[model samples]
Structure formats: structure tokens, C-alpha cells
Target chain A: MIETFRRVLRRLGSVETTSVLIVLCAVIALLGIFLPIRTSNWMVLPFALLMANLLAALATNARLKSQSMLFAFHAALVAVIVLVGLDRLHAMHGRVEVAEGSMFDASAVAAEHGLLHDLRLGEVRFLQGPFEITYAPGMKRRETESVIRIPEQNGGWREVRVGDHTPLIFGDYRFYTTHNKGFAPIVTYVSASGDSRTGAIHMPSYPMNENKQGLAWTPPGATKPLKVWLHIPEPVFDEAKAWKFVKPTNTRLVLIDGDERHELSVGEVVSLGSAQLRYDGLRSWMGYTIVGQSMIHWIAAASLMACLALLGHVLSVLIYGSRIPAAGAEHGG
Target chain B: MALEPAPRRRRRSHLIAAALVLVVIVAAGVVLEKMPGSGPTVATAPQQSASSGVTPFGQAFAKGIEAMRLGDAHTAARAFDEARAINPHIPEAHVNLGFAFLAMQRPREAATAFDRALSIDAKQINAYYGLGAALDASGDRKGAIGAMRTFVHLSDKKDPFQRKAMSALWEWEAAENGATPQQGEADAKSKPEAAAAKDAAAGETTASIEQQGGAGTGAKPEAVATKDTAAAEAPAPSEQKGEAGAKAESTAVAMLDTARRNNAPVPPPLPAIADMPDALTPPEGVISIVNVWASWCGPCRAELPSLQAFAAALDPSRYRLVGLNVDRDRDFAREFIRDTAVSFGNFWDGRGVFAKARFQVEAYPQTLFLDSSGAVIARVSGTREWPADAAEATVAEILASGQKKEPK
Candidate 1:
């Protein structure tokens, strides 16, 4: 039985096993990408098997004394794979867009966590500051600048620049700027019960749904829906490129129920027959692509080591290995 | 023996070195684990509670339809919504809700309603048509194509919406250039029937069209994403070092930009412009609309073609229309113009420095209207339906005014 187990290990660590696993991994990855399979599920098995194979190769194959470079390369490859596994176990990628001047919170984020991920994002705290963009004469956007405000230990919000190239790192999550940013209209809906609730209405994507600026909003406690749009005389998109992000000032919320449409500007109220709505000023939202991964540095280091060791291995074989063989030939002669 | 001993020594040394390297790699990973930037603290946050969305259906739904037939979408929405409150699972209710939402210009909600309708009853073929129209109007071109393709698939050629669905599918298919053209191939290979039915080849001829005269040239909208299309949207150069997770996540995150989304080709970023025009004034005796726009602006991109088309229809003798280009890269702007076939004169709005300083040109694609005397008459901010339904009548009216002499 022991001998059989040894044979199994031998086969498992063999190059043929590695090749098969690689091909399987490729196939699985392709299916995950083009098909409906969740990539994490498809990848885990091959990766786990690869890890075992790599460890077996290290244990049974290495000579344990001389070619440091070749050894380092294999070691680095192992580290990279292991680190990647850990990353997969705990990593997550999600997104959150905070309305400007609003606090970033858990409820605002839409996240999908990994299988083993313990989300500790409750501590992640930041407020969105004002953002700016620049455009050339021909109306091509040139630059984008957004600032994120974090509460300082001293009780003030410290600001940091975040843009297309700059990401905000808070609580192990890296927030990158994506191209999805737009307007949010703040309005207070007064129910028939005389209770008013205020909320933000995020418009459909700008310039994309620019012509159609309303969403169907069924106010809390109200059975009937109202079509609401922040009808700015012109959306404050003029501030960009000459570009600073801004809510369109003096914009009115046009509430439509059937053919009955009434406009209400800031601090003004429009009656919804049984209930009323107040136009609270408009606000803007900047979209962010959020990511959390474990051991980024370890993975990066392992990759660097792998490259260097491969180069060293190549040189040693080409330049030094040739010397030893020639020297042996001379001695034989 | 001497030569053999030396080769053996080298091999042994190499193995030992490899073992040591392994130790070091492990140690480095440990060190990284201890670092602040590596991982999040292990704290289990409570998951957000799921909504109990199942409502029962009854009388109020029927009540809402009366307002609907009278062309009062508001009433229809209320009635359908009431029916929804009682029972949320009915696909038919959602379909009517979608229509009511569309009537009220609430395309996103209409889309949500249609999507909900489909989720409940996948066989609700009309929901696909509603989804297509809503997605298309909402500027979700890729989503619109997918929904339309499904509509075309499930719909008979004689269906009223079938031809329109085909037209929309063809337009987006060309725009996407077969972004999802290989669903059947990938599915046939991988056997994910449900996903394949939804993904790949907005124009693939996998499913045979129902036998009828004048079915659209067989272009089907495929699923939300494919690996090839995902790769196409991914950031270049980084992709070489990128893992499978990053590639998939990038596509997913990009799609999540909107509720349901697709990626369009992005114009490369460029340097800021050097100059800003001093005035966005109109020429004398010509009523004008100085449309300020940037290349990066999504709405501006969609609106420009319509503006160009509108300009083409107008008599140049009475209309002075100018596009204010605020793109930083002049060359890219020219490329965009050429690609979009924009013929009108466009001036640079460098950083919008001049416009902001002169006029309160705060929004993108803002149309500043001017009467014949080059005097600014009005500022149309936000998004405008350039011609609205009155494009022809409006243009004719403007031409007549331009021709008439003012009372002395």
C-alpha cells in the first residue's frame, strides 16, 4: 500500500501531470470567460492541483545544493502561484459611487465577495470632494481631477487627489476612477400622511439618456408612481473641461403623473394631488471601480524573481555550462 | 571520475540552492502578509437583508388600466403598480407597467419592469420587445441589441415589433462589429445553453428565423459579454501581466457601470487645448444654436449625429449653427468629427475657460440660442430633443422668421 502511494505521488508530480493540468486549466478558464461558469469555481481545482504538483516537483526533483539561479526561478514561480491562490480565496472586486459631499458607507456599495472573503469594509470611510475635468477647444476631454476627503485623526477631513490614473486606497480597498459619473437630484416626497422623506434620484447615464432624464419613482407609502427628472435649464456639464463637476443650479424637478407635469425649483413645492414633493438642490456623483486583493506585493515580487531567475538560468546554461563541457573535453584528450 | 564528481557537485549545489530559494520566497510572502497594504482585517460584516419582493395580485391592477386606455400613463402606472403591490410575480402586470413607464419617459424603470417580467416568465415574448425599446432609448446600445436579438428570436415575423427590433439590432450590430458574434460557437463548444442564448453574435445565424416573409436579415443579439469582446474592452499592455480574475473582473466592473451595460470603443486621452474662443456669438441675420460639447461626453456623442442630421436638413442661408468643441486633443477631435461625419464649423472651448468667464456655459452640449441679430436669446441647458417631434415645423418657422423683416 505504501509503495502504491509513492507511485501515485510520482505520477502526480510528473511533467505529464503538469501539462495535463495546464491544458485543463486553459480549457476551464476559456469556459469561464465565454460561458456561464463562475471563474473562481473553474479555476480553483486546477490551481489547487497545480500547487500540489509544484510542491511535489520541488520536493522530489530539486538537488538541494548548486544552481541558485534555477532554484530561485522555480521558488518564485511557486510563491506566485501560492499568493494567487490566497488572493483568489480572499479577494473581491466591487464598485461604489458616492454622491458629492455625501459620506461613503456600506449601504451605498454594491459588492460581490470571494468565497472566503471576510468583508471588513465597514471601517472604510471617506467623503467625496469636488471633481474637475478639462477639455480642449475641439471638445475632447483632456484631464480629470477628483478629490476624496478622508477624516484626519485631528478631526478634519484631509483631501487627496483621485482621478483616472489616481486611485484612493482605504481599508485595503483600491478605488479607481471609471468613466461612469453623472447627476443626482435630491427631492423630498411628502406623503398623504404628512410625512416627508428626502432621497436622491440618480438619472440614467448622461449624454446616453440625456433626452430622457426621468426615472419612475414610487414615493414611500404612495402606491402611485411619478416620473421625476431634475430639469436643469442646461445640465451643469458646462463646468467640465473648463471642467469642474457641478450640480445644475436652479434646476427644477419635473414630476409627471400621466399628462400632469409640474416643475418645482429648489426650496419650492409641487403638489402631487394627494401628496406633495419638494425640490431639494441637485448633487453630483462620481463613480468608482473598487478592488480588494491580498498579497499584491508578494505576487509582484515573485513575478520579478521569476523573470530574473529565468534570465540567469538561460545565461548560465548558454555561457557557463558551455565552459564546463569544453573543459571536460580538454581533460579527456 | 574527476569530471563526473564535478558535474554531480554542480547538480547537488543547484538543488540545495533551489530549496533555500523556496524558503526565502515563503519568507517574503510572510513579510508581505504582515504589511498594512496586503489584506483586510478579518471581520464579518452583516449581509444586507434581501427584499421580500413577492407581492400578491388582485383588483387594483385592473383599476389602473382604465387611466391607461385614456392615454394617461400615470393612471396606468398607478393601476399596474397596485396590482404589483399585491402579487409581484405576474409577468403580464410587469409588461403593462413597462408600457406605462415608457409613456411617462421612464425608460430605466420600463427596462427594470421588462427585466422583471422576463425573470418571472421567460416565455413572455413581448417583454423582450419592451426591454429592447427601453434599453435603446436609455442609451444602453449593447443591452438594447441583446434584448432585441432575443425579441427577434422569440417573435414571429408578423409581430408588430419584429421589424423595429431587427432595425435596431442591425444598427448596434454594426456599431459593436460582432462584439458578441460567437455565442453559438462558444456554447456549442462549452454547452452553456442559457448563457449562449443570451450572449454572443448579435448577428449570428444560429437560430433559424420563423418562416415568414420579410424577417430581418438574421442578426441575433447575443449575451452580455464574451471573452473576446471582454479582451477588446480591457486596458491594453496591462492585459499581458493580468490574470484571469482581472480580465473577467474588468469586464464585470465595466458592465456594472450602469445597471446593465456594454463597452463601446474609447477614444484615447490627449493633452489640453491651448486656446479658448473669446465669444460663442452667432452670425448676423441667422438664428443660431451654439452647441457646446466635448469628445468625452457620452450624451454629446449620441446627440451630435442627430444635430448633424438636423443641420443637413436646414437651409444654411437662414441658420448659423456652431458646435463648441471642448476636447483637449485637437487631432482626436478631428478624427471623431471625421468618423461621425460632422460638417458644421466647430470652435475650441479650451478648458471652457472663455465660455465660463463670458457666459454661464456650465453644462455639456448646452445649446445657446440666438435670434438673427447675434444676440443671445436663451440658454437651453440639460439635454434637449433638438428637433423634438416638431423638427420640421420648427425649422420652417425659423426660416420664415429669418426671411421676414422686423417692424420698424
Candidate 2:
């Protein structure tokens, strides 16, 4: 037993063995780019074992001028690989499909845990879910009844929805929804001939500014041209008012009656003596989008940097070892 | 001899490195093979049809052509509308859609579609012709003539069909001012009939042109001679008859000569409008409503029904409604309209200007309400409600007061 141990140690400490180990490590680093190490719990143990074997092999090799530097560089690489493997064990990710006319809450679980992260919302169903949820940088979810369900890898799901944008950091993985168009404008049309008719119409919602003009429809050969205006719910008021292109919060359509004038609210109908007009509902909502927070993306980005560092270190060692005379031959006496 | 061990160890290490590199190469190749392919595949699956995959704009274009060929301005208008929903950049779609509107007797819509097509693609040939056709149909003869002159300038004069169509259109313009070839033929036919009527009144004998067999070739010359001789003699009934006969002979020759020179084949008379696809036949216990609208049409935009409300109120089993959008931009149309809770299908009419030429539509927001038998029970040309107790009230009435349709 003692003799076999001695022979094994001697072989491992040889210059030839050190050269072979360097070649093997370089090949493994290259392989990592394509067939990435499996980070799941089941694969973690095998990965650790492989890493331990590499460390042991590196440690037993004879010391040369650059040996300590190479060892330190490789040691850092192993540390990163182990850390990433642990992260994979805890990381969570999946996809979900929400049908038209439905709102999906992605925060139901995170709310219970009192955690929140930025969210993304895309294409709301006009009737069922009027608004798509999204998150801004550093935004957090407030407590609410809104529920969103996100799928988990282990055949479970997480719930989330509006009002949750931060404090929900589970491992390195965070969740987001797609951004989509959300603003829906309500338009009202009043006929000019004092018969107060009103209709409800919808227009695409634009960024909030008080200056945007509302669109109105005119009927063929109507006694009076259609008098049209828009009603925004939350009117942004300003004194200087340089930017009039911004949509107003409060808009009303005023029509002239023979003797009296009448005003129609957005999405309201009025009858002015036979010339019926009404405020039409929104035609469309535009310009909503969903995006992920930069932080989570940054965490995944670190793995790439580690990979590049290992690649550079391996190349330098290979080039230096090939160009210089063998250290073992020079030391021979 | 001393180099033997070093050389053997070096060779062994080199072989191991070479093997490791080969393994890495093979593994990378395998992984690359599994990577996703770039872009969408154009090779359609066997189950998919070319027509089904066509964008909304293409579908509207094809439908407009089909409608024009069949002379059903309304149906053609609806189809062109579907095409415009897929793509608005296609100017031809708008031109053809306008033609459909024109044929439906909606001149205003035809003009708008033509104008829109020209705005998107200035060199659109069909839009120019459709504009002329719409103007001609709408009682704006001078405008029609001007548009036709533009059409003539733009058209390839070398094409036989186009040349004939241009000549016929010009002739129609001329005829509107004075006597036409058809009118000349009628006058010729009338002269003989008048001679017969005069003979009955005067109690005198008149030579029947039909009786002059083989003398047919000499008929014109003899008729002229007889007219001169009678004029020289006395103011008798025969002299009056001879003058009418000579005029009739000249008119007939002119008519025949014009026909020969133009080599113009008379087009079959316009098909009865009712013979066209009136509307989609609704299932039993259902009312089929077709709403014709355009994106730029303000009133049409205002009166757009709350799809959700309509879908909720109307029992799908009893009522079906379709929106026939005449929008020039397919993306804008789809994005704007898709959010509505309308359960029924939508169609695009591609005849931008020609819709008016083909459909004779005078305005937008035209609602054609049809019964289950597909017969148009009533039509609302503007934004107004049908009487509360009429066959069915308009969408505005239903949403405002929760008005329900009484059973027919």
C-alpha cells in the first residue's frame, strides 16, 4: 500500500504529468462553452468531485517560476464554477401564456413572501384586463389583492400582479412580464345642431400631455358638422403650457343647441332634439411594453466574464510553456 | 540513449493533448447542430393553403378583383376590406376597394379610397380609372370626364382592351351632350314606323322598304332620288314619306359604319344588382349585420359598437354581426379593431377608390341589416338608429338602452 502511494505521488509530481494536466484543463475550459456544466442539484455532486480532482492534480505538480500564478488563476476559476453550480441549484425560471381578454397576476406568491421585483406586461385583453402590469427600475410591489402566477421548474407555480416591483429576490433569478400598449382614450362627439346627440368612441392612448388633439367622426349630410373633443380622466395642468401635444386628463365635447349649449363627457350620450350623438369608447391602446430589471441580467453576465478569464489564462500558459526551455532539464544534475 | 525516457514521455503527453482537443471539437459540433435555425421558414406545411396564409391586404385585393368580375360591389367591398387589414402599404388594394364602393353607389367612399391609394402610391393606375368611374356614376359628369382624360393619359394606348374602353367612355361623354350611336339606331328604326303611321293617317300608298328585296343595296340612292323628285313636284303625303325614308337610310349606314370602324364588341348589359351576393346568409334565428367603415371615417369611428357589449347582449345563437372595415392600413385596422369583443369575423375591401365605382356607396358607416335569408331587410347609410320597433335597431340603440330585438 505504501509503495503504491509513493509511486502514484511520484508520477503525479513529474514534469510530464504537469504538462498533461494543463492540456486537460484547457480542453475542459473549451468544452464548458458548448456543453455547459449542469447546475441542478443532482449534477452538483459530480461537478464538485470533478473540480476537487482537478485541484488535487494541480496542487501535486512540481513548482516552476509561473506555477504559483497558474495555480492561483485556476483556483479562482474553480471557485467560480462551484459558485455557479450552487446558483443553478437554487435558480428558478419558466414561461407562461395568457390568453386574450384575461389579466394574469404574477405576484400572488411573492406578495405572500413580502417580496417584489419589477414586472413587464404585454397586450391586455380589452374587455377583461384593461391594463398590463410592468415594473420600473428599483420599483417594488405594494400589498394588494392582485394575483399573478408564474410557473416553477419543480412542477409548481408562483403568483404575482400589479403593485409588486421589489424586495423579491429568490436566489439570482428574478421575474418580469412583457411590456405592451396600455393607454385607451375615450372620445365624445356632439352634433352642432343643438339637438344634443352623443356617442362614445375609443382612441389609442398616448403619453400624457395636455396638448394632443382629439379625433372626431362626421356623419354624411348631417345638419351640422360633428363637434368633437376628448376627455382624459387625469388632466395634467400646467401654466406655461409649452407642450400641448401631451394628452389631457380631462376632455369634454361641447355642442351648440339652437338656444342652449350642452357639454358631453367622455363615454357619455346625450340627445339634442333628434340629432342623436354619443361618446364612442376607445378605438385602441398603444405603446405598452414588458422588460426585465438590469440587476438579474447583470448576475448572469458575471458567469461570462469568468469564462473569458479562464480562457485567457490557459492560452498564456500554453504559449509560454511551448516557447521556453524545459525547467526539469535545466534542473537535472 | 539518455533522451529515450524524455522523448517517450513528451510523445505520450502530445498524444493525450491531441485526443482531448479532438473530443472538444466533436462535442462543439454536436451542440451547434442542435442550435435554433435563423428566421421564419417559408416552406409551408402540407396542411396549410397558400390562400389561408395570405396577409389581410392580399386577401382584400383578391376579393375586390373577384367582386368586380362578378359585379357584386358590396361583397367585393367587404373582401377588399379584409386585405387592407393585413397590409396598408399595398396601394392597389385601396384602389380596388374604392371601385367596389363606387359600384355600390357610394361615390364619397370611392373618392376617399382612390385618394388614399394615390397618397400611398402616386403611380397607381387602377385608382385613376376608379376615380373616373366613381365620378361618372355619381352624376359629376365633368369631373368624370376630367378623371377619364387622366386615365387616358396614364393608360397604355397599345393595349386593345384599354383603347376600346377609353373610346367607349369618351363616346358616352359625347352622347351625354348630343345624339349617340344607339340613339341614331333608334331614330332609324323610328322613321319607318313613322311612315307607316303617316300612311294610315293620310289614306295614301307608301312603298315599304322591306318589300325592296335585292334593291337593298340601291335603297339609300333610290330613297334620296325619290325625296328629290317629290320635293320638286308637290307637298303630298308621299313626299313627306320619301324625306323620312331618305333620312332613315343615311342613319342606318352611319350606325353600321361606326360599328365596323371601332370593332367594339358591345359589353353585356350590367347585371341586376340584386343578382349579386346580397349578404352572407345568417343561420336560423339570427340577424346578419354588416357594418361598412373606414379608418379615416370619423363618424364611422365614433359609432363603432362596443364589441364587448354587443357580444354580451346578442345571443350568438340568434345574432351575428360582421365589421367590413375599409381601412387603407391593415396593421392600424387590425390593431385598432382586434380589441373589440366582436365575436364575428371581419373583412377588408381592397378597392380603395374603385369601391365607389363598383359598390356605389355614397358614404361611410353604411350598415346593411339582413335577415336569415340573406335579403337586405334595411340599410342605414349614415350614423343613425333604425326605428326602435323597426326590424332591428342600430348598435347605438342596443348599447344605450339595453334594447332587445323583438322576434320577427
Which candidate should be chosen as best, given lDDT against the real structure? 1
The TM-scores of all predictions, comma-separated, are 0.47, 0.24
**lDDT per residue as tens, model 2, B1-408:** 565675456545544533443344344445553444222212211211111133344334444543443335567668777766666666656665665565455767877887888898676555665566566556666776676667667755532224423644655566678854454653343432222222211211113222221112112322434443434344444444333232223222222222222222111111222234444558776777667776567677666654324444555676677666666543334433422223345566643343344345558977665567665555567786333233234443433453333223
Looking at model 1 chain A, report the run of 10 residues with the lowest lDDT sum: A324-333
lDDT, candidate 1, at B54: 14
Report per-candidate DockQ: 0.07, 0.02
Q: For residues B1-408, what per-residue lDDT tens digits would candidate 1 score against the true structure?
A: 346686577667766666666666666667766655312222222222212211134335434433442335577688778777667766667776776676576779978988998998897776776677678668787888888789789865544335445745765676678554344553345423222212211111111111111011111121112322332344222221121112111221221111111112212222232343334444566667678787678788778877776777666676667787776535446435533556776777665765565556767877666665545565656565667445657655544554433221
In Å, residue A75's CA in model 1 sits off its true spot by 2.4
How many clashes in candidate 2? Answer: 129
- Docking quality tier of model 2: incorrect
* Candidate 1 C-alpha error for residue A94, in Å: 1.9
